[model samples]
Target: MRVVVQRSKKASVTVDGEITGQINSGLVILVGVTHDDKEADAAYLSDKIANLRIFEDAAGKMNLSLLDVGGQILSVSQFTLYGDCRNGRRPSFIDAARPEQAIELYETFNRFLREKGIQVETGRFGAMMDVALTNDGPVTLIIDSKDKKA
Candidate 1:
């Protein structure tokens, strides 16, 4: 499991010109699942992301977690995160999980976030969607469950 997390002031996703998910003062998370990703991976990431202290504090220090500020999440399914372009112009999606497995884990990841008492909104999985956001601090980070060093 992998995610590209972007801190945002406001965000929304549109499908077929209709708003699907939207949020204010939160993170826009692009989630991806690989062939070997499991529920444990989703759990780990949800915990880590909910507690990541990327938001600022009263003293202008980056010390507030999303939990601290009561932020929302705009989650988007992004299989292309696993695209492998090492040897050719065309990206290979062989490392990406099949839709059946991917959607299950993706829902699990969102459920874990909601269980943590955070509001989560999500785009339609496997849909052609349009996402827009006002990136607060332009702060973004990439995290992968497979990179846990323990």
Candidate 2:
């Protein structure tokens, strides 16, 4: 499991010209699952993201967690995160998990976030989505569950 986390002042996702999900003063997370990803991967990432102190404090220090500022989450499933372009002109998605497995883990990841008492909005999985956001601080980070050390 991998994720691209972006802190945002406001964000929204649109599908078929209709807004599907939206948030304010929160994080926009692009989630991706690989063939070997499991529920534990989802759990690890949810915990890490929720507690990541990327937001600023009263003294202008980056020391506030998402929970500290009561931020929301705009979660979007992105299979293309696994696209392999090492040797070809076209990106290969062979490393991405199948939809059946991907959606299950994706929902599990969102559920874990919601369980942490954070409001989570999500884009429709497997759909063509248009996402808009005002990136606060332009802060972005990539986290992969596989990077967790034993």
Candidate 3:
């Protein structure tokens, strides 16, 4: 499992010109799953996302977690995160998990975050989406459960 976690002042997802999910002062999460991703991967990533501290504190140090800041999460399913571009000009999506399996794990990931007491919103599964955000601090991070394990 892989994720692009962007800290945002505001964010939203629109499908077919309709807003699906939006958040204020939170995160825009682009999630990806691979064939090897298991339920544990979701659990791992969600836990890290909830507890990882990037927000600033009183001294302007990045010491606040999302929970401390009362931030929400706008989770979006993004299989393209798995797109492999090293081989050729055209990216190969062979590393992406099948939709059915990916969706289940994706839901589990969201649920896990909620279970950690964070508010979460989500994009429609398997949809072409337009996501917009004001990236706070322009702070973005890539997290891989596979690498985190090591």
Candidate 4:
């Protein structure tokens, strides 16, 4: 499991010219899954992201977590995060999970976030989506479940 988390003041996703999901102030999460990803991976990332302290506090320090700031989440499924371009000009998505598996984990991930008491919105899985966001602080971070030292 991999996720690109971006702090945003506002964000929305449009599918076929219709807005599917939107958020006022929160993180826009681009989520990806690989062939071997398991429920544990989804669980790990959901907890990590929910508690990540990227939002600034009153002292202007990045000490506030999404939970602390009562922020929303706009989660988008993005298999492209697994794109591999090491071989040629074109990228290969061989590591990305199949749509069936991807969607299952994607929904599980959102469910995990919701269980954490965060307001989570999402783009349509397997749909071509146009996402728009005002990236707050332009603060972005990439997290991968496989990177855990343990």
In model 1, the runs with Cα more than 4 Å from the true position are none
Candidate 3 at 130: error in angstroms?
0.6
lDDT of 1 by residue, 1-150 (tens): 999999999999999999999999999999999999999999999999999999999999999999999999999999999999998799999999999999999999999999999999999999999999999999999999999988
Model 4, global lDDT: 0.97
Q: Which ten residues in a row have the lowest lDDT in candidate 1?
A: 83-92
Candidate 4, position 50, lDDT: 94
lDDT-best of 1 and 3: 1
Q: Write the per-residue lDDT of candidate 3 for residues 1-150, one digit (tens) a residue.
A: 999999999999999999999999989999999999999999999989988899999999999999999999999999999999998699999999999999999999999999988889988999999999999998999999999745
TM for every model, in the order presented, reads: 0.99, 0.99, 0.98, 0.99
Mark the 10 consecutive residues where model 3 has the least summed lDDT: 141-150
- Residue 111 miss distance in model 3 (angstroms): 0.5
Q: Would you give me the overall lDDT of model 2?
A: 0.98
Clashes of 3: 0
Residue pairs clashing in model 2 are: none
Error of 4 at 105 (Å): 0.5
Ten contiguous residues with the weakest lDDT in model 4: 141-150
* Local error of candidate 3 at residue 70 (angstroms): 0.8
RMSD of 2: 0.5
Clashing residue pairs in candidate 3, if any? none
lDDT of each: 0.98, 0.98, 0.95, 0.97
Superposition TM-score, candidate 3 onto the true structure: 0.98
Q: Write the per-residue lDDT of candidate 2 for residues 1-150, one digit (tens) a residue.
A: 999999999999999999999999999999999999999999999999999999999999999999999999999999999999998799999999999999999999999999999999999999999999999999999999999989
